[model samples]
Target: MREILVRNTDLSEATPILAVTEASLAEVLAGLGQSAGNWCAVNDFSGRPSSCLLIPSAEGSGATVLFGVEETGLPHPFALGAIVGSLPKGDYSLADGFPDPEQAALGFALSAYRFEQYVTPSRKIRRLGVGKDVDLDRIGIVLDGVKLARDLINTPANDLGPEELAAAVAALFEKHGGAGRVVVGEDLLDENFPMVHAVGRASSRAPRIADFTWGEASNPKVTLVGKGVIFDTGGLNLKPGSSMSLMKKDMGGSANVLGLASMIMAAKLPVRLRVIVPCVENAVSGNAFRPGDILSSRKGLSVEIGNTDAEGRLILGDALALADEESPDLMIDMATLTGAARVALGPDLPPYYTHDEGLAEDIAVMAEAAADPLWRLPLWQPYMKYLDSKVADINHINTSGAGFAGSITAALFLSRFVENTESWIHFDIFGWTPADKPGKPAGGEAQGIRCLFDLISERYSSAQ
Candidate 1:
C-alpha cells in the first residue's frame, strides 16, 4: 500500500523514464546529445537488462532517467521493477520507447511493496505519474490483492494463529459485502471435518474451517480451497532448527486464495465464488496425532498417517472433499505441500496438477500472460499405488517409496477426495522467494494467484 501514483499530472511536466535496449542505445544516446552520451560511455552503460543511469541537465540537476530493457523478444512485464530501488524520489512518466506503459506502472507499484508490519520502511520509492492510457483502477485492484497476501504470509505465528487467520477471512468477506462463516474446534467433528480437527487438536489455539461466499448463486460455481496450517512443528515428527525456521509460512496457501478472492470480488467477475480455508496448527503435545495413526476423513475414507509433517495434504483432503460435494464448475486447491516440488522446479515456478488437459493448456497460456509461471504435472494414476495402505483406504504419504515423486503422490492423495468435481487443479507452491528479485522480495510471496485470476476471469466473465 505504498503511494505509487501522482494523479492528474501532465506527462510533459514529469521526468521521462526512457527504456533503452542494447540495439537502441546509440540512437537513444544521440537523442539525449553529447554530455549525456559521454556520461553513458564513461559509466560503461551497455543497456543490459536492469541496468539504469541517471542523466544530468546542463545545470547539473536531474533531467531524465535511462532504464535498460532486453535487446530481443517482448518486453518483460516486470522490467521497470528494477528501477524502483535506484530511482530518486520524484514524479516520472514513461518515455516513448517504453513498452506496455500500464504494465510498467504496475511493476513500479509492486516494487514499492515492503512488509512493514513490525518495522518502518527505511525509504519511500519514487512515485509515477498516471498516464491517460493506463487502467489505474485495475492496477489498484491487483495491488490490493497482492499486498493482502504478502501481509498475511509475512506476519509471525504468535500474531496470526488459526483463530486469527479465520478472523482475517471474515473481515475480508465483510469488506466485500459477502457472507462469511467459521466452524471452529469440536464443531469441526460435529461437521464431519475429522482430518482437520485431528491434525489441529493438539494446538491450544484450536482448529477451524473458514468459509466465504460471494456473487449470485445462479452464476457458474467456482470453489477455492487452501491449506491454512498457521504453524507446523511437524507434529510428532519434529523438524530440525533449520527446517522449522520458517514454519510461520505454512498458511501461505490460504493467504494466496484470499488474495485471489480479493481480485475476483474487486473486478466483479460474474461467478459464484466460494473460498474454504482449514485453519490449524500442527503442534506437538500429548494429544498430537502421531505417525501410523488411522483417522477417518470427511469423504468417508480412512487415512493412515505415514508422516506427521505431511499434514498439509491431510487438511486439504477434507476441504476438497467438502468442495467436491458442491460439484463446482472449477475446484482449485493451493498448498505449500512438499519440498519435492521445490527440488524439481525450484522456488519461482510452482507445479500444478489436473486431470483436465484443456484446462492445463489454458492455465499455461494465462500464466505466461500474467507473468506468473506455472508448470503442469500429471495426476499420474499409476502413482496412486504408492499411497496404498494395508489397514486403511489410503496412506497420508508414500513412506515406503524411494521418495521419487513426492509431490505427485501428495497430489494423488488429495485427488481421491475430489471425485465429484471433474475440473479440479491442485497447486503445490513454495511460498517463499528465497532472495529478492525486482518486485518480489526475500520473504513470503504470492505465487499463482494472478495467473489463476486471469484464467478465472477468462472462463467466467466471457459468459456475462
Candidate 2:
C-alpha cells in the first residue's frame, strides 16, 4: 500500500498542496505574491474541480501543488487524487483551507495503487504528510483492504484459480490469527455442496468453498458470502470475444468480501465474522453441466440450469444456503452476477437488493457517508415467478417475461436459499472500473465493501 502518514513536519521543508475552490482561488493566488499570481493568471487557472496546477518553488527543488475542489455539494473523497501521479516524488503537506484533509490523504494513497504483479510500476507516487486530526491507522487499514481486493481481482485466472483464491483467504486468516478451512474437489460433493461442485466440475482445477471464522462466536453473527467464479467462459453458452475478455474478474465478489473481512478484522469490530466463498471456473468441457440438467443444492432445492452464463448464482445459492443454516444476525452475498445490474446502475454505482427496509435505509445512508455508491433495487416478489421450472424446484435464470428486470430476478433466485435470515442483502456489483476516475483507476475496484464495513462497524460497535 502507498504511504499515508500523520507527521509533524515544518511547512518550509515540504511542498504545500492548496485545495482551491472557485471562490477561494483569487485569495490563495494573492498569498503567493505577484510573480506566482501572474503565473496563475497567465496559465488561466480558474480552479475548476479535479484540476491541478504545479508551481515551482523559489529553490526549484520542490513545488507547490494547487488542487481544485467543489465549493458545495457532497464531499469529493478523491479530489486530491488528481495530484498523485502529477506531483514530483517528494513530501507534501495540505495547505490551510483544504476541505476534508483526511479524505484527501486517503485519495492520494489510493491513487498511488498499481497492480504490479506481471509488470513493474514505472513511477512512484509522492507521499503525503497529514495533520493530527487525520487517523493514519484507520486510513492505512482501509487502504490495505482496498488494495488487497484490487490485487486479487486484477490477477489473471492462470495464477488465481479456485485453489489460489482459497489460499488467499487462508493467508488472510492466518495473518489475523483466525481459523479457516477449505473444502475442495469431491469434498464439495461429500460435504453436500452439489451446486458448487456441479458448476465447477468442468474446470481443470478443482472447485472449493472456503469458510473463515473470526471474532467471538457469542457476538452478533455477521456472515458474508461471495461468488468466486475464477473465470467464466460462459460454459456451453459461450460469450462473444468482447464479453469474455475480462472474465478473469468473475471472482471480484470474493475479492471484495475478503477485503471487507480485512477491514473488520483490522478494526476489531465486535462481531463474529463468517465468510463463505464458493470458488469455481465456469468452463466448457465434456463434463461441464449443460442446460436442462437438474442439480440438487445444499438447501435441498433442485435447480435447473437455464443458461450456463448464469452460473454465478448457482454457486452462491449453495454458499448462501450454508450461511443461512447458521441463522446469522446479518447475511450478505455479493457477486458480479448480472449484466442487467450493470445496465441498470452502470459500473460506478452497484445495485443491491433486500427485503428489509430498515437495513436498506441504513445501507443507503452509510453508502453516501462512506462515498461507496449503492442503489437499492426491490426484491419484487412478483418477479419470483419468472424463475419457475416445470421439472425442477427453480430455474437458475429466469427465462420468462422477455428478460426484463434481470437483476431483480437474479436476486430472487438467490433469496430462495436464504429463508432463515431477516437481514439478508444481495449485492450485484460490476467490480470493474471501465474508466479512470479521481481515487479509482480503470481496473478492479471494491464497489460496496467500505459502506458495508461502516454499517457493520456501527451496528456492532454500539452494542458493545
Candidate 3:
C-alpha cells in the first residue's frame, strides 16, 4: 500500500496553506490576514483534467497547492488520484474546506494503490494528509479491501491460479475468524461439480470451488458467489488476441465478492455470510471441451457449449447450485460474463439481473448512495428460449434465436441453477476502467462492491 493518506492537525500555526483560483484565493488569503498579491500568480487556470498550480508562500517553506477541476465540480475519485500522484512526498493539508470531504479522502486512498509484487519500487515513499474531519481508520479499512480486490484481479494467471486465488480468499477468511475450505482438482469431479471441472480441466492449474462461511449459524443467510476464472483463454472456440489481452481480470468477480465479504465481516454484520467461488482457468489444449460439446452441471442441467468462450457461466452454474442447496435468504452472484453486456452498457455501468423487484430496488438505491453505479436489466423470461438446445438441456451461448439480449440470456442460464432462493441477483460487470475517471483507475476495479456493502449494512446492521 502507498502512503496516500495525509493527516491534518487543528493547530492554527501549523495549518498548511492551499491556493485556489484567483477569485477563491482572494477570500481565503483575506481570512488568513495575508495579502493575495504576495502569492505567485497562476495565469491559465482552466478546470480540466490533471490541472494544477503551485503558489509560493512568503517563507518559501513549500508552495501551496491549487488544483483545477471541472467547473461542474471535482471529477471525483479520479481527479483526486491525479492530484495525489502529482504531489511531492509530504504531508500537506488543505487550508480551506473541501466540498465533499468523504469522497475526496476516499479518492486519495484509492490513487495510492500499487500492485508491486514482482519488483521492488525505486521511487521514494510519498505520503499525504487529510483534513481533520476525515475518518482515516475507517477509510483505511475500506481502501485496503478495495486494493486487495484490484491487486488480485491485476495479477497475472501464472502467479495467481485457481488455488492461489482461493488462498487470497482464505487469508480474508482467517483474518475475520471465518471458516473456509477449498475443494481442488479431481475432487471437483468426485463431488459432482462436473461443469466446473469440464471448463478447467484443459489447464494445468486445475479448478476448484472455494467455500467460506462466517457469522452465527442461526442468523439470516446471505450467500455470494463469484465466477473465478483466474485466466480465460476462451477454450476451443478461442478469443481473438485483442479480446484475450485482459482475460487475467476474468476472475474480477471473485475478487469483488471477497472484497465485499471482507467489509461484511469487518463490520460484524448479524447475518450469516457464505462466499462460494469456482476458481478455474479456461485454457485451450487437445483435451479442452470444444464448441458443441455437452456437459452435465451439478444442478442436473445438461448444457451445450455453443461458444467455448462462454465459460464463466459454466463454473458459476456449479457454484450457484451449491449455494442454492443451502437456500440462503439472499444469494448474489457476480461475473465478468459477456461482451454483449459491455456493448449494451459500457465498462462503468454494471448491469444486474433479478426477478425480485423489491430486492432490485434496494440494490439500485444503495448503489447510488455508495457512488457505485449499477443498472438493472430485466430477466425477460421471453429470452430464455434463446438458450434452448436441440441436443442438450440448454445451450451455453445463444446461436441465433432472439439475437439481442445476450446479457439477459446469460443471466437466465445462471438463474436456472439458483432455486429455492427467492432473492437472487446476478451482476455482469466489466471489472476494469478503460480510462481514468474520478476515483476509478485505468486498471482493475471493484464495481458494485460499495453498493453491495451498503445494502448488507442496511439490512444486517439494522437487524443486529
The clash count for each model shown is 0, 0, 11
Give each model's whole-structure lDDT.
Answer: 0.89, 0.88, 0.81
Best by TM-score: 2
Pick by TM-score: 1 or 3, better one: 1
lDDT order of candidates, top first: 1, 2, 3
Clashing pairs in 1: none
Name the runs in model 1 displaced over 4 angstroms: 6-13, 71-75
TM-score per candidate, chains pooled: 0.96, 0.97, 0.92
Per-residue error for 271 in candidate 1, Å, reads 0.8
Provide the clash count, candidate 2: 0
Residue-level lDDT of model 1, residues 1-464, one tens digit each, is: 53686553644466788888898989989989999999998999988877889898999777888888876532578778867777776678776646777777877887778888789776655778766778888778888999999899999999999999999999988888899799999999999999999999999999999988998999999998999999999999999989999999999999999999999999999999999999999999999999999999999999999999999999998999999998999999999999999999999999999999999999999998888989999888888899989999999898666887999999999999998899999999988889878778779899999898889988988878
Of candidate 3, the 10-residue stretch with the lowest lDDT total is: 10-19
lDDT for 139 (candidate 1): 79
